[model samples]
Target: MQKTRLSASGAGLLALGLLAGLSAPAFAQEQAMDKLKSMRVSGIDPNLPLIPQTGKNADAIKENLKRVKMPAGFAIDLYAIVPDARHMAVAPSTNMLFVGTRKSSVWAVTNRNSGDAATEVKQFAPSLKFTQPNGVCWTKDGFLIVAEHNRILSFPAAEFFYEGADVAVSEVVPQGKLIPVEDESYNHGARVCRVGKDGMLYVALGQPFNVPPREKLKAFTEQGIGGIIRLDPFTGAKREVYASGIRNSVGIEFNPKNNDLWFTDNQTDGMGDEIPSGEINRATKKGQFFGYPYIQGKTRITEYGYDKDPVPANTTNPEVYTEAHAADLGLTFYTGDKFPAKYRGGIFSAQHGSWNRTTPIGARILFTSLKADGSADKTEVFADGWLDPKTRQYRGRPVDVANLPDGSILVSDDFAGAIYRITYTGI
Candidate 1:
């Protein structure tokens, strides 16, 4: 074929068309940023560092590691240095570890080898401002979904796209609409999401009040605030209220053995440290309700329940009762093949040391074995010592737990802004 030589005017037109084509998405991204800026989204302020400082060096992690205690055959080590690392979702297909935060960004933590600490800690989407994009999950279809306080962003082929450049952003739930944009409150809006075995998205939304007023309860119950909301990942079109009456749940997971939904609910506060206990509940149905403002754990609320509406009849009580002020946050079932036979189907969770109690509590990890009927066998401390026993100071606070393919677990510490890996290596 003969080469066609173009005139200057023709070449100029071609270049202009090419430029417009390439700049389209960039222009859209810029427009989106401008809109968010104009709206003055509450939690997107970059100057605000949620935690004091992040990026802990090996020395600091080693010093803190001395204070962590695990089981007799288990060992813990620093897996990655992630800033403000809150909730983590591991993509086995890409070996990409995604860490969410309660501030402006989400981080991709990469470990070259299985046992080594992460060498590369890169921000996933640097373009759009993530306002408390605290909920992160890996969908079965190999997509990543981040549910934030006011928005939800999805990245397609996230692992591969980050190789050439950052992945293009796809809005899963539009900005300023994940919850009521006008009534947006930072109280308990930070969420933790997971792609259910049914190939749908699950997000836990905390109600944002000590107790929502009676008039607000009906709307909240209907909209799923203080509940688990299900979403269709493909279009974000199928959204439903899965559970209700959970006060402030920051962690949720499905039992690998039975696919039953289990979550950690932070019970009502101001009811004193010992009265209203925190919860580890198992929901067998879609519309299950866990007692919250009306009744905390199994006890009727003495402070607010008296002339108010009574506890809803079909409310589900927690399977295991964690102590009040424990602040149970994140959890994962042991599905890896590395641990002993007894732990194959057990649960491991983090307690993000309490702040409201007179004396400090939590700052430890809890374990619960599963019953044959999918109930709790027993609950005990799996890991502890993050809070100094003598000084009553927090060395580190664990926020969430994610298990690796090899059966080891990664626990995120938002207070220290780092991730710790736990493995079994003893007899």
Candidate 2:
């Protein structure tokens, strides 16, 4: 049963940061309502044009999908046309998906028929303006939390009421408090978040630099920069650093079996093509550090005098290492039964490919099989052909991977501005 105090008559009175199974006192609930009332949209026009769902642009995306190659029994098709799609959150109780963008908009996509494609796609909360709202997550109790470049907001009951322009909203982390204004950067600022099984919100904050100077390390660690932080979803209280020494992590997920936190960190640049490797790290407990500036994926960072500094004794290295400059971004653990047995409890990660490699690689999806102890056993490419081998051009760069209700998976491509659903047919 749902643990919220929401009643049939007072459903609209839902407040912000309402983590599931946590009960608030009467005064606390009233205070939340008061705060919710003050969170109003300002300075943004509500009648902004919605993205075109069906057009010549969408047909171009569909044409590109025909070139994408997966396993023999699997097929991929266009699911929706979302501009600047960065990350996605699939609603648990509603047939809707909230997609975030690096621009000023979040999109609401409706799959009313449970068909192969979305029927309606529109801007969510047209009345508000978002700044690089690239991170989105949904709670089991019906709240949609959007983590922007420098702020975080929560919408209560956003799944059911997103069709309207106005939705009840509150601030999970107010603007300028996510990070200092001076520390915000155009690069490495895309935040990603997930709700943990313990009813806390875990957010990854990327440090904005190729390699941060040693003088900034103390301040960054104190502020949870270049690390993952967990906080109380209700009222944004009890904020604490969960993990440290991460360079710039854009993908994070909690393992379903043991609830261990796993993430993908993009390593430092300008270190040649094949030196420091991008990392897939696992944090089994809080306060764990993953060796960022001193070491990246078992390679000591010599640039910016990082190698001169002494490494911490408690620093934990990455569990799995991918090729350098592969730009591994989003990942998810497959817990569904529709796929073959080999993929049941493994992980699917998207490598956005490289930017300035001598020869480009990794515009595809990769899978990692796990051992009984939850350690990574083997890693291999699961899908490719997104990058043309001869031309070295990317047809689509995959960003994030998500699961559909039917046990299939959805992959978001920002380059193609579309989401593709991949399903197994058992041939």
Candidate 3:
């Protein structure tokens, strides 16, 4: 929809518009070079610091830890202090925690399994320069997969070789071509990746627009922008679109039971405080389209899905919706037995909070439960209080979450440049 009015708080919204820049252009002549030019855009540089970084002591973390609220028998503690931490993946075999960011490096959190905060944190592949390598996944075979702004890389036995510069990285998808150049823009370049049950790699490509311009729609559709694309992990061949019309999705997971896909989507902004809510969607089959630039949440984008053009008949609505502008980011299904019985098989999502609203919403962890039939039944706040309700100041912003092998959950906060572990000990 058209946003005719902009408020004072809209500055943050505008900043998001700028940071989210980085849409792919159509693959055509000079596209590769155009991709390079676009990558060097002033504000969206890989070297530029995206989040505030500072020293956080245990005393300070312990003080702020009092602010968090959770269910009985559940508690939260600082897990590790990871700078600019975003998406995370827990290695299946080694159980190492690999963190991704929108800057120049990736991180590994170690000594977490012991009864302590992480004793050590190190950068993965310190020798190689990374560019917004914000999407990460640990494969079933003890490998680490990373998706960058312009390419995808896989590191075999990443943990063992992470200490030295001799680490070998195999390029899964060559850089500068993941997103088309003709449609390239400035926003939404941080990708989230996962290996589905089918042994294919699925990566999220958020269309870089509040509402896509008409000229860009064709290219977005053709290049699989604003959708999830799957390819054979070994050959990077046999590519196909798994979902479409997603504005910008930063989190994705597969239900271990049915092997269906689930993702969290950030909704359109500047629509006031509560018009379009962020979403958690379930894709039961291939080629499903979750409406964007057309349908938003359960409501249609008034300006676009009318007149000659209309909302697609097959648009699938989100199974769950958070408060408007919650900026939901990463999510994982609770397959661990660490928590209470009720939490098993439920979905845990992180809401990155709102920037455009005068009254902020969602800088916390959320839970969505399913009925026996597997349809999403309800969504509720699981943990909160990161944002001070009194001063409206944020001490931290929850960006993404990864469930640990020990039954705890790792919550990443870019604002505070740290990660926190939440565990249940029983009252």
Candidate 4:
């Protein structure tokens, strides 16, 4: 069951913000609707629900799988089961998928044929001590980069195929420095990192917490310690800030058409279940601030009460907003011809659902069509039903999404510890 309520104050604040920019009422209405569309709510039940233990009966696993929802012509099939998996990456050239687990190890899953099951699954790196492998990316040179808690590890793709009891091709390229956590707030820094089209490695270092003070923010922004940072993969030369004022951006990707970078950011918690929705923003230029701690979606609601210090009026707003606490994660653009023509350049984002809201939201994948100018026109649910509103329980939690070589979309569910492949077959 789903409940709907209107926050007139929120709407009024949005309308006022729009009016300050545009005089036309029609345009303001459109902008207001856009803002509303981005607001999401989840975790209506404040009490922490018990997560079913793994290795339960098949019936129990099947019951938990109910969180996933798919369209009519598409079917969801399990591609692999990885226990404690959080983030993953795939190499199209080698037909291999590398999954990063929370257990400080990386696993490589390979399929002999595209249509067949994964013929082999093995741990590629075992000596690595990771609090959690939060991000993984494959370079064009067949090197797999894994983002550990405070370091980056690289391994050759051929190490999996080399039959040996002990293969040692893994190398530590960069040892990450922990962004100082000001307060006792959560500071899990490992998010998304990828090699950009400019031949530079970009990593998103999330803020220390939901909202920090101005001094902390200044330190993070000026030093390129928070938000996104660009570095040389070989020399580790740090350069400009990709984007700033971001809370917790767990996923990032590059648009294939323009090579522009984009990310999904989870907003501050405890602001009801719908005030500050998660966001999707494009890194169009260096030092682009998305207005965190000061404003959310153009509204000035500072969690740390630092609004007295003037923030720039032109801080970039998100291209698209998701429901609050939806926990939007990995994002990708569909460049394959596997789906219909409409999905050609659209964006697919995985919503990891919510942990703090009273009403549950997210737990699905969403599609948004990007206009020629790189702004989203409209967003809609491509997949859903991950949470049972009646029971206030979840079947699965989607964490990431990727497109395969054959144009199919693959969604990774971190909660159920499985990856689902969705293929479209028109009637």
Candidate 5:
């Protein structure tokens, strides 16, 4: 699959390509470091004023409440506020919400009854740092597990609320290879881990650079570290390679009906705007390669020496192609009764917006109707106006999506440092 063709709006795409070339080399080696500083400053606007020095509002939640757009009869409201929170996970059994941060700590919020604010918040596993905790999931037995850099850590869900705390679980370093770098650069975004229906834990390991080839991609897929991996939940046993060749998949979910895995993978950069559109892929089998360094979409890149074996005519392409650099993250299918009948089994994905593009894209929630076989139909914008398309300024960047028991959806914004609840009020 060669890279998707550049799809930016005419002149804007040209300017963006020039800017990316200028910054690529300077920022390439320091990409992770740059992301860290930017994330700490909320990473919303590159041209805006620097983040404030003092007060809770330094990184306060900026609602831009009026700017939000949704379908008729659908109401969007503030769900909760947590400063510096990035990827978040919910444990419905215990009604607990766990939020990960760039500052190397995880906050657990409990007592989240219906229509009530998260009543209690506490920080556990304070000593863990290095890779930001990007993905989190809870086991059937009430164990709270988190993915931090190259390792996974587990603790009891009870300890999150218990005044007298005892750390019952020990962190287990998986018997897998890290992306051999002194600074762990290949561990970018390390998000999207979940316990599959097969009773095994799955984790996504991202690539190091924007679009690295064999030499630059060594130890990270060249040596096979990127893509998804499965491990035993309790003892960290039965480690197996689930899939490979994914660039950076931040959002993943299992289809409730068939238990098949699906993920949204952000495309590689340097290609023109539309050349390499992001993808939604179904993880059908173990060791099934989805291109990556070989091909972008259905096109083959000759420059990377991948033109030898032409992309097969029958090769599997994305189930759907999202807008280029929309930064798709956090996907879930609507299975609840609150929304319209047409929305049943529809896929909802959070677009975190794009920074490298000349014109801003994403920063909204999109809905896609899936067929009975789980293939995508026409994709539509479920929510929008998170970013001012003309000014290229963002009002928010949604990172994750989850549904409440009452059928409402929760979207988490790493930029605004808040979460928004969307409820359908239509008859």
Candidate 6:
């Protein structure tokens, strides 16, 4: 069946004359083709189908938005219905929003008119099936990079080409190459990525364990299993581990003002619901390690017997601590003009609510005010009411936050399967 599809795809490309100027890669295509279990291509696939944009699920999400709350003069509205939306990338050239999901699909969202919500949402490159493609980010020049469980792919001119089934696509990290095969697991596999000021693509790979076992420490460190790694997106080389000792980081953003890297790390579990707090860390320099198996938010993990092997002398602690088990995921610096002056250059993060606390705590948006030195002065709830106080049930769970060019911000909800636009219209 795979061979048949390849033949047809090749025929389709020939018929459309897309192969006229195609050039071979420095690496052999046959060598990489052997590694891909799914389809491989660098051309268009006209047979791909479009996902329906409107349905009952979208309507239900709209109704749930009625109960959502924000600060004074700020309103939340449904931007688009993107099922299983986990991370987002807003295009620099076209303002198109590409959303990723925990499952197989990546959606391209667009706002056709000014001062309105996104009207179109469709599957991106329907011919390819992505595994846990939860991280999406765009380069300054317009390449859309999607980070999956163990692979990364780049789409050139993604903003303009995404309207069709096939956009020019190529591999950054081929399947079975991002991590060692022995370490791959279903848990903690969602990846998030961002393009830094230096133009390197930084991707976070979460180690798949509640507490990273002591036996795997050496191997994990070498492979960046529990850390963030940066690579040249164009050639996928010049790769190096950027930060280490992070257990699971689903959200990462570079401070636009200083180019400092910030990420939210989910800490150890089963150590009481409130002992180890979730961490928001700042990486001012490369090679900085945040405690994981050795220490979690100042509380050392006695289980690993780190007393014999003391924690690293240069281990950097978290910049801020969030409520234990609150599950802080996506984060971004508020660098938009739509909000009031007080919010300029502040931080906005999404807490995706706890799964197994005695009582749930986080289905809301958090705001952190920064002091002159760029340190966090205070953190407060910017938006809430996603969790029903009376029932303790979640109406929506925000996974990631992205900013629109007009100064409005977008919140993606995997539970509600929608992207919501938050705009501040002062009274």
The per-model lDDT (C-alpha) reads 0.81, 0.86, 0.80, 0.70, 0.69, 0.85
Q: What residue runs in model 4 are displaced by over 4 Å at the alpha carbon? A: 1-67, 158-173, 176-186
Over 311-421, each residue of candidate 1 has an lDDT whose tens digit, in order, gives 778878888888998899999998888988878889998999888888889999998998788899988998998999899889899999888887788899998778988
Give candidate 1 misplaced runs (Cα > 4 Å).
1-56, 303-309
Query: How far does residue 359 in candidate 6 sit from its true spot (Å)?
Result: 0.6
Specify the poorest-scoring 10-residue window by lDDT in model 3: 40-49
Give candidate 5's TM-score.
Answer: 0.79
Best candidate according to TM-score = 2
- In model 5, the runs with Cα more than 4 Å from the true position are 1-63, 111-113, 158-166, 174-183, 215-224, 307-309, 312-315
* Residue 37, candidate 5: alpha-carbon lDDT: 26
| Model 2: lowest-lDDT 10 consecutive positions | 12-21
The positional error of residue 291 in candidate 6, measured at the CA in angstroms, is 1.2
Question: Which candidate gets the maximum lDDT versus the true structure?
Answer: 2
lDDT per residue as tens, model 6, 1-427: 4554458878887866654435333133433333332434435445545445567876877888888878899988888877888899988877578999989999888877755577677788765668899999988888899999989998888888776554567889987899987888999999999999999999999999887778999989988889999999977899999999899999999999998899999867787878688889899888999977788787777676764668888889888899988899999998899899888898899999998788888999999888888777788899998998899999999999988889999999999888899999887
Ranking by TM-score: 2, 6, 1, 3, 4, 5
Better structure of 5 and 6 per TM-score:
6
Q: Model 4, range 74-99, lDDT digits (tens) per residue? A: 66666666655566787747677877
TM-scores, each model vs. reference? 0.86, 0.89, 0.85, 0.80, 0.79, 0.88
lDDT for model 3 comes to 0.80
lDDT of 6: 0.85
Stretches > 4 Å off in candidate 3? 1-56, 303-308
Report the Cα lDDT for residue 163, model 6: 67
For each of the candidates, the C-alpha root-mean-square deviation to the true structure, in angstroms, is 10.7, 11.7, 11.1, 18.7, 14.0, 7.8
Colliding residue pairs in candidate 6: none
